[model samples]
Target: MTIAHILHRVADYDAWRKVYDSVGDMQKDGGVTQESVHRMVDDPDNLLVIHHFDTMESARAFFGRSDLRDAMERGGVQGEPRVELFE
Candidate 1:
């Protein structure tokens, strides 16, 4: 199994969550098998999102998408996001 981990800050968690929820189809299309989200205890705006994929190629492909950035921006993401992969 492979996983994509993303860390970022959002301006508003509620708004961001709505945008995140709206991308269910995109996530399905991206080969994501499962996902989870976490927030920093002390800094609620900080987020860590995890996505599980069957292969590293799929994980990379999903994260490499240009439109993912646009979605994040629309969700009120506040800065550059950090992405990592694990297998």
Candidate 2:
């Protein structure tokens, strides 16, 4: 089944842009296929990241790794990201 991963952050556009740019190469190398990425117009600070994989297991395997977590932290992520998985 296909899975969906959602992320919500409370940082400004510049901050989020910096983090997104920093992770560009890593995300490509990590096997995450970006489906779509968008920011709410009403709330510029809110962002939604959507990615898809062959299975939930594959998604978890990639997301559960330490390198991604480290990259996120180093990218100045202030709070815990809300993650949701769905078919």
Model 1, residue 77: what's the lDDT? 95
TM-score for each of the candidates? 0.95, 0.74
- lDDT tens digits, residue span 14-55, model 1: 999999999988998999999999999999999999999999
RMSD (CA, angstroms), candidate 1: 0.8
Off by over 4 Å in 1: none
Error of 1 at 19 (Å): 0.2
- Look at candidate 2 and give me any clashing residue pairs: none
Tell me how candidate 1 scores on lDDT.
0.92
9-79 per-residue lDDT for model 2 (tens digits): 64466765776677777666655666677778887677777877767777777678788788667655558
Error of 1 at 55 (Å): 0.6
Computed on alpha carbons, the lDDT of every model, listed in order, comes to: 0.92, 0.70
Candidate 2, which ten residues in sequence have the lowest lDDT sum? 2-11
